[model samples]
Target: MKDEKFNILLADDDPDDRMFFQDALDELSIQATLSEVTNGSDLMKFLENNLNKLPDVLFLDLNMPSKSGMECLSEIKKHEKLSQIPVLIYSTSANPEVVEILYNMGALYYIRKEGDFSCLKAVIGKALFLCRNTRLIQPERPDFLILVDDIRPKLPL
Candidate 1:
């Protein structure tokens, strides 16, 4: 499994944020293939069309043009075929109330988008590592929100 490439799907409307995510992933030591969709509707279409090959992990943004990430998350969790895939909420805002709601909605993790490249790399790396090593289950509230600056000690890649 170490040599196998992970499939990652990101649904973000912001072009700059998408580019930043790709750049950060490119710098990581892990081997991964990233697919992007501009909005929630496109994301659902992609997932529905690729049922046989769903991404290992989904990095979903909260805000979008069409359906919101919260809506997508709910739809995914309710769908039998899509429920198993782990979803990590990737957004700029980290409101405590919203985080709590997302957690209850079955989001595997919540990662606050950072401006620094290093922080982005670190958080992305950590998220990928966890998704690979841990079971696809929602963690406790304490471990649900992944803060870029809160990260300490190098995670094993």
Candidate 2:
């Protein structure tokens, strides 16, 4: 794992969000390869096609065309082959109810997307570090949300 590049899949409909995410990852020190899909349908297809080489983590957006992130998440969780992959909810909505629902549904983390690049970089770096170093697929309820302002102090740099 140390020598291998982390594989990340981003499923987002918004072009700007996708670009922002890529930029954040670029600024991080970790070596990673990112694959992007513009919509949910394409995301699923990409996953299915790459079963032998599935991504280490998936950063999924809440709202997408063809299928919502919730729908995709449900399907991913239900599938035996796909259930082990860690999913991080990367969305603008920080609604508690929705976060709880996603957490219960088996998402590893919920990150509320902020416009600040540094915040985005911090949260993404934290998520990647956790996924790579720990066996914790899903954290306890209180630790589920990955807010930028709240993350820096909690995790090691």
lDDT of each: 0.92, 0.90
Model 1: lDDT to the true structure: 0.92
How far off is residue 69 in model 2, in Å?
Answer: 0.3
- Give the poorly placed runs of model 2, Cα more than 4 Å off: 1-3, 153-157
lDDT of 1 by residue, 29-92 (tens): 8899999999999999999999999999999999998999999999999999999889999999
Cα RMSD of predicted structure 2: 1.7
TM-score of 1: 0.95
Evaluate model 2: give its lDDT.
Answer: 0.90
TM-score of each: 0.95, 0.94
TM-score for candidate 2: 0.94
Model 1 CA RMSD to the hidden true structure, in angstroms: 1.6
